[model samples]
Target: MEATPGASVATAIRLISRDKAAAASSTCGPGLASPPWAFDGAALPQYGPGASAADPAPAATPRQGALPSEYLEASDEELEARISAAKSGLGDRVVILGHFYQRDEVVRHADFVGDSFQLAQAAASRPEAEAIVFCGVHFMAETADLLSGPEQAVLLPNLAAGCSMADMADIDSVEECWEQLEAVFRGRETAGAAPVIPVTYMNSSAALKAFCGRHGGIVCTSSNAAAVLAWAFERGQRVLFFPDQHLGRNTAKAMGIPLEAMPMWNPRLPLGGNTEEQLRHSRVLLWNGFCSVHKRFTTDQITAARQQFPGVRVIVHPECPMPVVDAADESGSTDYIRKAIEAAEPGSTFAVGTEINMVRRLAAAHPEHTIFCLDPVICPCSTMYRIHPGYLAWVLEGLVRGEQHNRITVPDDVAAPARTALERMLAVRP
Candidate 1:
C-alpha cells in the first residue's frame, strides 16, 4: 500500500518549522499552561524516600546515519547493513526508539518499539547511548529527551513529524480556560459539586504535563484513561480533560457517568463559555478538542461502508468524536486498531477511522479482509504527514556525518519537575 503522497521534503520541513515557530511565539498566558518548547529533564520526583535509582553513565560510540535511502526504500539486506553500520559505528551510544504507529520498515530498525511512555522509558534505560534516534513525532522525541540524561541527544529522523491533536490544546488556550474555571469555583464549596482536577492525555506537551503536576493532577494514555479518571475522581469532584474530548467522554461514560454529566468546555468561549451552574454540576469538563484526522470519520461513512460491503464492522480511534464512536463497532489505540483487524475473521470488511497511513498499511497487511479508511477522500494527520522521506534521508546522513540537525532537548530546570509529573503517571500501575 502506498503512503498518502507526502509533500516535498523541503515543503514539509518548512511547514512544520513554521507551525513550531507559530506555536512558540503564541502567548502561553491564557487557556494554555505549557510553553511551546516545554520539556522535563531527569530530576524527577524520587518515588521512594531513599536510595532512588541512578541513571547509568552514557556510553560513547561511533556516529550514526551511514545510509540515506535505508530509512525509506532499502531492501531487507540493505536495511540490515544500514543497521549493522549504525550499531557498529555507535555501539551502545545510540538507541533507536519507534512508536507503535510507525511503519514496519522503521520499527524494524528500532532498538525498542512501544507506546509513547514505553519509548521514553527505553530512552532513559539506555544511559550508555549518547544519541537517541526517535522514529515517531516531535512530542515523542521531546519526551525521550526529557526522560534521557542531558549528555544524551534525542534526534528525530524526520523533524516534521508531529501530532495534530497534540497541537490543538495549546498552552495559552489551556491556561486561559483554567483561569475562567478558577474564577467560577472561587468560594463555591457547595456540597455535591465537582471541584477541578486537570487530566491531560499522554498526547500532550510536557508543559501541559507540568501544569497537571503543579495543580495536583496527572497524565494518562488511552489504555490507562479509565484508571487515571478513577484516580482523578478520587481527588476532586470535577475533572478537566484536555485535547481529546472523545477519550475523556468515552472513559467517563464507561465509568457510569451520564452524557449530561459530562459537559463540553469550549476554551474559545468566554468563561469557557460554561455557566457556573453547568460547571459546578458537571463531574467532568470535557474540552472542545478533537483530532481533525479522526473527527473526519462520521456515522454516515460507517453506515455507507457497511451497506456497500455486508458484514462490515467499523472501528475507530478514541480521538474520534463521540458520535462516530457510538456508531462504530469498537474503538481503541493504534495498536488496538491493528489488533482488531488482524484478529477479525477472514473476508471481513473493516472501516477504520484514524490516520490514513496506518489504515492503508492495515489494508495491505490483511489481504483477506476489506479494510478502508472511514474518510474515503484519504485524510491523514497533516502534521504527521510532514515527515517525508527526504527529511529522513537528510537527517540520517547528517547523523552519520556528526552534524546534528533536529535535536529535541529539554532543559534541566523544566525536566526536573516535569519528570516528577511523568513519573507520577508511570507509577500509577494498571
Candidate 2:
C-alpha cells in the first residue's frame, strides 16, 4: 500500500492495517501481524552521542502497533472523557504545554498554549508541577526537561514527533563547521574583535545549545532574533547562525546587512562551499537548513491571496524563504502573528504564511478578521501533527495509572550548558 501524499507515516500505517484486516476477514484467512509495506531501509537517528544526521542507519518496521489498540479504536467522546478525567485527577501535579502549531484536539487540553520560548518559560514557572507534558515535538520536550525542575518529568506523547529542521544541524556537523571556520579565521582576530560567536536557534538539539554555551554563544527565538544578533555583534566580528538558513538570512537582512554578507553554509560542501573572500566578508554564516512546512509557502501564493482579497495584510514566519518573507507585508514569530491580528481593526483581512492549523484556529477565533493561509494546499508541520488525540489519551491514562511514558530526559552534561545558553537568551531583552 503506497502512502498518500501529506499523510503522516503513522496514519499511512494505520490505513494499511485497516485495509488488510478487512480483506482477511472476507477471505477467511488469518490477518497478517504486520503490514507488507513495512521495510528496513534506515533507522531514525536518536538524539544522543555519536548520532549522525548525514549517515542514516537501517530503517526498521513502523511502530504503529506500539500504540495501544484500545486508544486507537476508542471513539472521540471516549478519548476526550479519558483525557479530561486524567487531567482532573492529576490537577496541580501536571502541566500540559502545547505549541501554536499543535492540532486543535491536542491544543484544547493544554494548560498553556504559546510559542516554543513561551512554553519553555511556562514550564519553568510551574516548579510545583511534578510532570510537564509537552504536546510539541522532541526538541520541545527536551527544552521543557531542561527548563523544568530536576524532579519534574517532561513527557512527549509521541516519540516519533521530531523536527526535520532541528535534525538537519546535528552536533557533529556543527562542530565540524566550527573547526573549519576557526582555520579560516585563525589570524583574523585583532585586539577588539574576535572571530565569530555561535548562536543556535531554539529549534536545535540540546547538544547544539550546549555547544553554543561552552563557546560563549547564546540561544535565540524568532521573537528576539534581531536583538540576539545585535548582542552577538557586540562581542564578535561575525555570527555563526545555524539550523535554519532562512531565519538567519531574514533576520540579518532586516538588520541592514547586505545579502552578499550572509553566506549559506552547506554541511555537505567543503568550507561550506564558499571562497575565503566570501567567508571573511560574511556577517552571518547561515546554515543551509529550513522548516519543511514554512518552505512550502511561495511568492505565487502570496500574490494569489492579494488578488483574491484586496487589502489583505500578509504575515509570515521568519523560517520562510527570503522570497516569501520579502513578498509578505509583515513577518514575525507565531505570537507576533496572533497579536497582529488582534490589533487589527474589525473585518481586517490577513493572509498568513505559516502552519495551516494555526491559521485555521486564528480564522475561527477572530471571525471579524478574514484570516487565511497563504498556501491553499493543506500543509501542517507533519512531526507536530503526529501527536494525535489517541496518543494524548494514552499518555494521560498512563499518568493516571502511576506510569510515566515517553519521558524526555537530557543528560546532565548537555542540560547544564544548554541551560546556560537558555539563561543568556532569557536575560536578553528585545
Candidate 3:
C-alpha cells in the first residue's frame, strides 16, 4: 500500500539513526539493506558455499548468570533436557514461530512456521502464549512483540539474526526523503493541507510502524500490497512508500499507476531530484531501496536461460526490480515463486529469483523441472545465515532455566501506535 501524507520526515530520520546505532551495539548482525539496481562485487562479499549439514555448529557461549554447567554446554542430551524443562515450565504458554528460510532443525521445533506476515498473525492470535520464541531474524521477533499482547514477551533465539534487505531502508534516509518531499509539496500547494501518505513494508521496524500510525499511514505485506495501496489512495492523493521500492513500484504498476508517475525518492539526492511540480504531480514516491539478495537476479540471466533451453518459464520474487520481474513470466512471494515452478509441466525449465539456498532446495525438491537461481552466483540471505541451530539450543536452554536471553521488547509507546498500523493491514479483507 502507499504511504500516507504529512508523516514528519525529520522524525523518521532521527528514528533511522537511532536504529542503526542500536543495531551496531547488538551481538547480532545489522538488519537487511534495500535492493540495489545493480550489484558490484567490490562492496558486497561473495556468497559463500552453504555450510554442510555435517559441519560442526558454532558452540554457544554460556550466559554469565544462572543454569548448571552441564546445561550450558548444550549437547544433544542437554538440548533434550532443555526441551523437557521448557515443556514443564512454559507448558504450551510459549509459542515458537519459524520462517520458511530457517534451518530444518529450527523449523522442526517451531509451534507455528510460515512467512513473516503469517508468523506475526500467529503470534498475535495466541492470547495464551506468554512468550513467543521467534526463530527467525531480529525484525521478525520485533514484529511478534508488536503484535502480541503486552503481557507476552517475544524472544529471538539469536539476536544477530537479521535481513540485509531490511537494513537498506534506514529510517534516517526515509525521513530525509520525506522532509524534502514535504517542503516541495507544501510550497506548491495553494491549499495548506498535505497530500502525501507514508507506507512501510512489513519487513521494517516497529518504530517505523508507529511512524505510519502517528501519521495516518498503514503497513503492508507483499501478499496484500494492492489492497493496502487502495486503502492509502483512499486516504490521500499520493503515497511515499519506504524500504521496498520494488514492492511499491510493482504493486502500484499492477494497479495501473504509470511508471512515470512513480518517481523514486533518493536520500542521496540533494533535493531528492523532484521539482516542486513533480512532488505535487506524483502518484507514488518510491524510496530508493531493494532486497540485496533478490537484486542479484539479472535480465541477462533470464535471456541466457531462455536461449539455452526453449520454453523455459521464468519465475521470480517481487523483491527483484521491475525489469527483472518484467523479464520473468511471473513474480510473487517466495512461496508464490515455488508454486509457479511446481505447477509447471515436465521438461519445462525454470529460473527463479530469491535466496540461493531456497532456490537450491527447490531445485532438489523438483527434479522434473530444471530449477535454477536467476543469479549465476550463489547468494544466501546474509542475515538469515545467522539463524543456525546452535543458536537455537542456546536460547531455548536459557528459557528452560528461567533466565531471559535476547528478549526483544517493544516499548509500550511504540507498540501502542505500531499496533494501529498493523491492525489496519490485518483488517484488510485480502
Candidate 4:
C-alpha cells in the first residue's frame, strides 16, 4: 500500500510532519494528521480520516476509549513485534478476519481475508477458536458475533471503526419511518397480496437486522442484494430498503424496475417524503442514506478514465451512484471487481472504483496489467483505517494476558432475529 490512509499512512503523516514539504506531499495529511487512537476531540464522534471524514457519526455509534499510552508511544516496529508475539502465544485460540479494505500492514497479519460478505461466512469456520478478532468496522464485528458460537468472543481492535453508510439508518429513525409506512400501505396486503417487505443491507447494525426479522424482512450483502431483492419481490408487493440508497436503487433498477416506481425515504419527512399515491405505486422505497466513500465516484470520473487510458476497463462497486455504475464497463461488488481482475487477460488496464488500498493491492498483485483507482485523490474508508497496527497489538496483548477488550456482543433479543434474517440470506441461492 504505497500511501494508504491506514496505520502506515497515519504513521507516515505523524513521522513526516517535521519535514514541511515532505509532509505536504504525503497522502496522510490535514484529514488524518493524528493517529487512529487520538480523535480530534470534537463534540460528536468522527470517522478519523478518509472518504467519510465529513460525515457525522451517529450518537449511538460505539466510541473507543483511548488506547494505553504504550501502544501509542511504541514505534511501528515495536507494535509489529508485540502483535506477532501475541499471535504466536495464542496460536489456534484466536483467529483474525480482515476485510478487503484494510491496509497491507494489517492484512498481512490476518488469517482470513475477503469482502464483508465473505468474512461473515468465514466467521463460523473457526468454531473451535476462543475469539474472533475482526479487523473491520463495528457492524462487521456485530455480524461476526451473531454468527460465531455463543462462547466465542468477537473483538474489534478499534471501537470507533464504523461504516458511515451503516450509521445513516438508526433503529429509532427506522422504527418511526416503518410506522408511517404501515399507515401508507394499509389495506394493501388483503386478498393474499404480500405486504411491504424490509430488506436491509449487511452493512447495517445487528439491531436493524433484528428489526427486519421481526417485521418479516431479510438481510442482504452487495454480492447478494439482487437475489435478496428477488426474494422480497416474490413475496411482497413493495420493499423498503435502507442504509445505502445507491445499492438499493442500483440493484432494483438492474432488475428492470423503473426509476418512477422507486421512491426515496427521508426519515425526517412524513411518508418518507412521498405522496400517498406515490407510496401506493412504489415498488421499492430506498432510504435517504449513502456511502460517503462510494458517493465520490461520478460519471465524470469514468469519462476521464476512458479518455486517459483509451482501452481501460471501468469496473465499479454497486455502492456507487447509479450513473457511475451505468457509465462503467462493468459494475459489481468488491469481490466481483477482485475476481474480474484476477481472471482478466494479462495486458488489461483496469480503472477500479472502490477503496484505495484494495485497488493498490490488486495492482501490485498482478503487475502484468495496469490497474488504478478512479479517484486519484486516494480516499480510503477512514473508519477502516482506524484499525491501526497499534490497536491490534493492544487487543492481542490483552488476549494473551487472559483479558478481553472491545468484545462485540449483540443482545439475545437482537441476535435471535438478526440470526434469522442472516440465515434467510444464506438460504437464498446466488
Judged by TM-score, which candidate is best? 4
lDDT of 3 by residue, 203-265 (tens): 887778888888888998887888998988877789888788999999899899999899877
* Model 1 residue 22 CA deviation in Å: 34
User: Per lDDT, what order, best first?
Assistant: 4, 2, 3, 1
Which portions of model 4 miss their true places by more than 4 Å?
A: 1-29, 40-43
Write one digit per residue (lDDT tens) for candidate 1, span 1-430: 1223332222222344345444234311121221111211113221110001121111221112223433445544565565556556766767888775554445556788777878988999999987888877777887888888878889886543556567667777889998888888887654744478888888887778778878778888887888888887877888999879989998888789998888898877886776878877899888876666666678899889888987788888887778888888888888688888888889888888876657766776688988877876533344433333334445555667787777887666656666777777787876
lDDT of 4 by residue, 1-430 (tens): 1333333434445555656676556543465656776673556788877788878877766788878889889987998899999999999999999999998778889999998768867989989899999999999999999988999999999988989889889999999998888887777795665668999999999999999999889999898999999999888998999988999999999999999999999998888778999988999999999988788888999999999999999999999999999999999889999999999999999999998878878887888899988986656789998898999998999999999999999999999999999989889987
Q: Between 2 and 4, whose lDDT is larger? A: 4
Name model 1 segments beyond 4 Å from true.
1-88, 100-114, 188-194, 345-347
Best by lDDT: 4
Model 3: CA > 4 A from native? 1-91, 187-194, 341-349, 364-370
Report the number of backbone clashes for model 3.
25
lDDT of 3 at 201: 92
Q: Cα RMSD for candidate 3?
A: 12.1
- Residue pairs clashing in model 4 are none
TM-score for each prediction?
0.75, 0.87, 0.77, 0.95
> Of 3 and 4, which scores higher on lDDT?
4
Report the Cα lDDT for residue 311, model 3.
Answer: 81
Estimate the lDDT of model 1: 0.68
Q: How much does each candidate deviate from the true structure in C-alpha RMSD?
A: 11.8, 6.9, 12.1, 2.5
